[model samples]
Target: VAIMGRNKKTLDEAKSKLGNGAVAHQGDVTKFDDLDALYAKVDDKLGKIDVLVVNAGGLTAAPFDQVDEAIFDSMSDLNFKGAFFTIQKALPFLNDGASIILIASIAQSLGFPGMSVYGATKAAVRSLSRTLSAELADRGIRVNTISPGPVETPIYGRIGVPESQIDGMKDQFREKPLLKRFGEASEIGTVAVFLASSDSSFIVGEEIIVDGGIVNI
Candidate 1:
């Protein structure tokens, strides 16, 4: 297993938890050079990659009217451009038949006041999966996306929700999903594992919504 992030400390911590065999590379997906370094490390340590998960992204809540150019570019650079180039550069390192899993969001299909830009980027990722699936089919590779709803993570804090108000915000969001709660990170991981494994061999260019029925219900 190999993981890449911008923080060495966080990367090392994750590497510890993921086991000693997991390779942790410190780099930003938004930077082409960083991505190159990441893949180079992967090639040196792991040989060919069988699964590539493009999960480096974030959200900054701002109403459409208040979204500035910086906000727009930041979202696009990391979400859309980052995911695109990450996969493009991984082509050489990916073994034939490898699975590429993109982490998108359910907001792509919804109308949220401060989520316009974020949703748009996620929608782009979902679209990329379909086109790339066809483009990579000749090599037996499968491209898919997992659009998670409200999962338990640090997204709320980063999106401008105050620390004190996070629990309250979660309470309000609980009503959005039919499950009456936010999803666990492990729940999303399980789906990614399935998509990465042979269990989902036939699934391609698909967007699996692990949203606790939020989008459907």
Candidate 2:
């Protein structure tokens, strides 16, 4: 497995932790040249890839009034445009029968306060999966989106949610989701593994929501 991110330290640590010939490259996903370089390295080292996961994205929580051109561009560039080119540039390196998974968010369906821009970005990701699935169907490529709801990650703090509140945030996070609890990263990983493997061979252009039943409610 290979990982690419802007943080060299994080990438190195992840590579070290996932020591099964995993490699890490530092690059900004929003840059095409960086993505090209990353893929060049992949092509030279791993040749054709069977599974590609595009998890490069960001989230913002602010009222619609706060949505400005800069905010829109930043979010769209990273979440939508980045995902688009990440796959476009990887087309050559991707194996014909491979699976591509995109990490989206429950924000796509949720009407949470201050989530207009973020939600719209994820909605684009969800829509891309469908169109890409049809566009690549003849090539045997599967494109799907995974919408994770309130997963346990360090992102909340980055989003300016105070740690004190984060501790008890889950209880009042949302009133839906039959599971009544936040999801674990590993749970999402398990589902991703299933989607990437032949087990989901028949599944295509579909969304596998990993949000503890958030949208279903």
Candidate 3:
């Protein structure tokens, strides 16, 4: 497995955790030059990759009226543009039967407050999966999106927002999901692995929502 990230410490830690089966490449997905260099290195080392998961993004939200261009560009570049280019650059290095999984969110359809821009970025990813799956079908490369709901990540604390508001949002999120709890990272990982395996051979261009029935109920 080849894992790429911007932080060297995090990359190294991931490499250590995966043992000898993983290789870490430090690069920022937002930069085309960085992606090119990373893929060149990957090509030299592995020739081709069997699975590509685009997970380089963050949560940035603000009310439509308060959202500035800087915030807009920051989220767009990392969430959409970066993701698009990552897949594009990986084309030459993607094996014929490779599976491409794009990470999206339930926010795309939730119409949550202050999430318009962030939701738009995720909506674009879901749309991209449809077109990309069709484009890569002839090559047997399946493309899909994993739309997760409120996973137990430390993102709320990182977002530049008040503690009370964040806590309130979390409370509302917790009460709404039928599961009555946030999803674990491992739950998402299992879905990803299934999508990358032959188990999902017939599932192409589908956006699988692993959000504990949040969207439905």
Cα RMSD (angstroms) for every candidate in the order listed: 1.3, 1.7, 0.9
The TM-score leader among the candidates is 3
lDDT of 2 by residue, 1-217 (tens): 8789998888888999998778678999899899998988887777889999999988765678978888889899999999999999999888899999999998898787777888898999999999999999989999998999998887877764466765655666555678777889999999899999999999998888888777786
Displacement of residue 83 (Cα, Å) in model 1 is 0.2
Model 2 misplaced regions, further than 4 Å: 161-169
lDDT of 1 by residue, 110-188 (tens): 8777889999999999999999999999999999999998888867878965677668767867987788988999999
Please report, in order, the local distance difference test score of every candidate based on alpha carbons: 0.92, 0.87, 0.91
TM-score: the better of candidates 1 and 2: 1
- Score every model by TM-score: 0.96, 0.94, 0.97
Q: Please provide, for model 3 over 56-157, each residue's C-alpha lDDT reduced to its tens digit, 9 standing for 90 to 100.
A: 888776889999999999999999999999999999999999999999999897898888889999999999999999999999999999999988887878
Order the numbered candidates by TM-score, best leading. Answer: 3, 1, 2
Task: Give the Cα RMSD of candidate 3.
Answer: 0.9
| lDDT against true structure, model 1 | 0.92
